[model samples]
Target chain A: MLDFTGIEKERLRARWVSSAEAPEFVEEVNAFIDTLKELGPSPLKAAVEAKKEEQKEAPA
Target chain B: MIETIKQHVAGLLTEKKIAGFLGLIEKNGHVAPHLFKDGESLAGFTLGDRKTAGDARYPLNKTLVTLSRAYPEETFGVLVRGCDERGLYGLFRLNQLTEDRVIPVGFSCPAELSEACECRKPYPDSLVAGEKTESSQLKKVAEMDGKDLARRFDFWTAQFVKCVKCYGCRDVCPMCFCKECSLECEDLVAKGDLPVEVPVFHLTRAMHMADRCVDCGLCDEACPSDIPLRLLYKKTAQIMDTDYGFTSGLNKNERSPLSQMGPAK
Candidate 1:
């Protein structure tokens, strides 16, 4: 997770919560969802989709 | 200088110190890496002219690795420039070859060649020939540093788009010794893609190179598209130095910080 943190910082987040801390885990998940919504779709995903469409539209 | 190197190599061969001496040989006006088994064959040996750096350059360390693996008990000697010595240190750290098994005959690069390579250390650890000169700085990275994030991203993407996915960079690297490379992993990098996923391909390599890259500049030399790979890996080396005062090929006993499992001390 620390390695991935360097590449997609905004998209990926790591939180420390033990199995006993259900409430804390839920809170962290909710916060991450909000962050993702604010950040919108990843540019890499968008690029891949756009490339797929371009390939589909190209001549056979 | 060439005569001195030839004499030293002949001495090593005659003394039975090394089974074979891996050095450049000029035959039919073409210079290539060859293994001289005896002093008789040493007559064909030539220290490639310093005028053409590219012609003189070959992955001698890589050949040493291959030969050493085949003949584990047999010792070998090789001619090494500054970059080659650094690469040898990296290989030693990786446990690819023992220091005792490979004898390095060191030489320094000329000032012009050093400037052209943007080399930091123009001579090896123990210089047998040539004089040590100051290391040169890479101007391309400095130029890129002035650009904004978006501009830099665009610049890199445009440069990466020219890639034909030849993997010449990997093939030519002396320190790349992985049996199964992450670059070839289909899950990470798709197959048969002409340009490959630009970020996934390049960034993945850059991350892997952070601790391993010795600033040899071989990747940049091998790239047919003229992609500034040395600059990218140099940035990784800088990051490693800043975050954890570690640089590749500095000392054989010191392992790369990234290679450790726990947090940096």
Candidate 2:
């Protein structure tokens, strides 16, 4: 069921890499990259268009 | 004006009436808000040409409001401007602050500051400083209001896109009193993003500001991106003035149009 209360586990971005061939850091970095891929491109294009139009008429 | 303020404080303290006097204190070339007591230190109490470290409006207002909330039974004095007075008035309308507990020391803003702020009134309901001056109507509000919706959207979106999410604007806003701000809501504003989305981040703040914004222009200054935030809030205030024929901080009895609507008696 979808949590209606909107409480989600705290998503943290932290990494500790020890000297000499840290496989864990590389794995975590790769995982973060995969998450970014899942999220896909942001939806800022339409909003950017809207904002440009407003500036044309504002006072200098 | 300084002497006048001191005299008033002296009287209030002599009568043991007010708990504190909230006004400007110049220490080391900085004029920030300070709470003055009877016998502590009045030497630093000098007021003139306040060099704003990103809108002193919010800091001063926050001090008074916090003091009032902490000490409910005590009365306090507040130095106010057209913007500060209007913000307080808006707060009063919203039932955020009590007028009875606040003594207003009104001052007229200089021409440069007035023009920069585009203030409608440089004086408050009460006066203790310089003479009253004419109100300045910011041309930007009307200009923006006349724009087509798409153009308006574009302009504001670009402005919001540059937002650093520093919360300086919210932090410096004297009228912003929400202990839990909607901007901080992970769902609405999103978390861990530098400049969250356009309408989502800024638009939410603007909507919340609606009838509550006092056109202090502090938010604009506090914003590192220099987003024309004052123009947006100014627009909101204009809508309130036009639609309801009400302005903040002028009257003690009028309720803020946002939470509760009261007849303009």
The candidate that wins on DockQ is: 1
Q: Which candidate should be chosen as best, given lDDT against the real structure? A: 1
The local distance difference test score of each candidate is 0.78, 0.70
* Residue B147 of model 2, lDDT score: 66
* True lDDT of residue B37, candidate 2: 83
Cα shift from native, residue B128, model 1 (Å): 0.9
Residue-by-residue lDDT tens digits, candidate 1, A1-60: 112212346566877899999999999999999989997765554544554555457622
Of candidate 2 chain B, the 10-residue stretch with the lowest lDDT total is: B49-58
Task: Kindly list the per-residue Cα lDDT of model 2 for residues B141-171, writing each as its tens digit.
Answer: 7776566654665566566766778999998
Scored by TM-score, the top model is: 1
Writing each residue's lDDT as its tens digit, candidate 1 over B132-166 gives 87888767656766666556655565566567789
Q: Which stretches of candidate 1 lie over 4 Å from their true place?
A: A1-60, B47-51
Error of 1 at B120 (Å): 2.4
TM-scores of the candidates, chain A only: 0.63, 0.49
